[model samples]
Target: MSADDTDFLAQRFEAHRGHLRAVAHRMLGSAAEAEDAVQEAWFRVSRSDTDRVDNLGGWLTTVVGRVCLDMLRSRKSRAEEPLDSTPHGAPPSPAHAAPADPEQDALLADSVGAALLVVLDTLTPAERLAFVLHDLFAVPYEEVAAVVDRTPAAARQLASRARRRVRGADVPEDDRVRRRRHREIVDAFLAAARNGDFEGLLDVLDPDVVVRSEAGVTTGAAAVARGASAFGSAALTARPTPVSRHALVDGAVGVAVLVDGRVERALRFAFVRDRIAVIDIVTDPERVARLDIAPV
Candidate 1:
């Protein structure tokens, strides 16, 4: 392709970049990996016969979906067990971590709270790709089938099965009472964490829960329970006065630990079936300072 031809194609690709990123992120559950997937799509798009592609957007979306599906399959093959076997709850280097996005954070909290990603992890790669494309992105079933290399009928079935599972595990986002219940459950969890009650935590936590903190990521109910026990030691004094407040951290139900009006730690909890599935604690100074924490 000529220089100007390549430039024009690049500009056209840029138009779909944000959308492609969103699609890939939903499929892969990591923004970084999504970028990589999108980049790969761009490479394929650039080299492919553009004339033969009647619909550029649809073609690129399919390519990205196929790339993500392959990646997911490779990851699954390498794992000792299933995807839920280990949540990516490991401690992060805040200094090196990408700048926080409150909108994305809130969305993630919602996704995790509803166990959307956890449930998505359970789905077969074809089913996941089919569902995410057709259901989430409004891609037609025919296109979805093309991406997954399945018949249109099989694609519809894949999406149907995925939809049923997601609906079962999904939280009621539309219900005001359900929202209130989420806050109350999280508040109780915070109290339990403060009181050094391991069993209490276990009561609220899912069997395969994960907790991420400055110390490290704690996976499994037993380890998370032990960490809950350790948290109470510091809560004796550091959390004395008002205790912790249940607030909306970045527009999601989260607990904020304050020391004299300053947020010391932000606890973002994801509830699955009204039980805690993931606990992400952010103690980084810069990120904590950016939180929009308000009482429930």
Candidate 2:
């Protein structure tokens, strides 16, 4: 590519990095993977003869979409893990370790939530690419088909199937609403649990509340009690420690469960009115490293 062409490509890549990352992250469910996909797309775009392209933004989007789809398909064949294996219960990592740039942070904070990303993971690779490109990015079906290497009709079907999963009976509207109510319930749950107030815990918990740990490490309300009680007892027995700050996880309020300055857990809450609906406590250490947690 000529110097002018190189400069043009650089400008275009910078402009669309946020858009490309959003699409990739939605497909891959990991910020690290998404960044790699976008980098690969940029590599491809840099080598291509951009002078021949009529629309730069569209071309970049198509390349990023293709790269992300390839990653998704490769992941599916390699690992078949259940969804909801990890709950959103950990402190955010230090800001310097955050996987996304400032722009990406804003886009994710506003557009994608933790629950939505979980839903996207359930989709097949083709369906995920088609849905994200066509529905979320507003790419034309013809272009999306080209990126996914599918017939336009087939791509449409993939997107339709993915949409159905997102809008299915399993994902109730109430669950989405629960994201908004999660923070309040989490705060109340922690307070009551810390105080050993069984009545307080019962007041916040739904009659049939379920608390599942990462990879099914623990389950059910009783299990939740056992696990939480262990932590609470530690807090009471240990020397006075600084409290961790709380922040929104994909817009849902959550507590950053910290211990001795390192983020030990992230406790994301789900609520039905004033009652606790579900408490997802994510304890995946690798996943915890990606969040933007402020230091103690």
The best candidate in terms of lDDT: 1
In terms of lDDT, the poorest run of 10 residues in model 2 is 85-94
lDDT per prediction?
Answer: 0.72, 0.64
Q: What lDDT does candidate 1 reach at residue 103?
A: 81
So what's the TM-score on candidate 1?
Answer: 0.50
lDDT of 1 at 64: 92
Model 1, 97-129: lDDT tens digits are 345355854554455333567888889999888
CA displacement after TM-score superposition, residue 135 of candidate 1 (Å): 0.9
> Cα deviation in Å at residue 40, candidate 1?
1.1
Q: Which stretches in model 1 have alpha-carbon errors above 4 Å?
A: 79-114, 170-296
